[model samples]
Target: MTKITYVEPDGSRIEVEAENGSTVMENAIMNGVPGIVAECGGACTCATCHVYVDDAWTETVGGPSVMEEDMLDFAFDVRENSRLSCQIKVRDELDGLVVNVPTRQG
Candidate 1:
């Protein structure tokens, strides 16, 4: 399992043990973390699970898929680092991955 740290807009932290192959949004939603809505489950059709990966972890997480990139455009307060958490599959190499929740999600 990889340890993923999610920092909320208010600076609160939610650390979770993310199983390899599971999406980051799955880990957070399953853990009942408050920030992520995950409205469309892990389908990458909804932008509710949007997050901003830390600059250091961006390369490690890589860029989003076409579908995810399309959905991200609908997210609130998107940024260069914005990502659909459901598109980010956890892996052993991402053990210390850190992503920050946006101030709002819909």
Candidate 2:
């Protein structure tokens, strides 16, 4: 299991053991982390699972896909580090991954 940390808008942090092969959004949903609505589930269509990858982890996490990038146009408070958590697959190397969810979704 990977240790994933999700920082809420109010600075609250929720860390959980992420299952490998699952998406970050799935981990958030399974752990009941606030702020990730995941309206479209893990389909990568609604962009409701938007999150901001910690600056230090961006390079390793990589960027969004073409569809994910287009869907992000509907996300609220989009940022340079913004990403669709559903597009991020969990792995052993991402043990210390950290992401921040916006206060609201689009």
Each candidate's clash count: 0, 0
Where is model 1 poorest over a 10-residue stretch in terms of lDDT?
A: 64-73
Cα lDDT tens digits, model 1, 14-81, are 88998898999999999987879998887888899999999999998898888878898899998989
lDDT of 2 by residue, 25-83 (tens): 99999999988999888998898999999999999999988898999999999999999
Best candidate according to TM-score: 2
TM-score of each: 0.96, 0.97
lDDT (0-100) at residue 49 of candidate 2?
Answer: 95
Which residue pairs in model 1 clash with each other? none
User: In model 2, where is the ten-residue run with the lowest total lDDT?
Assistant: 32-41
State the lDDT at 47 in candidate 2.
88
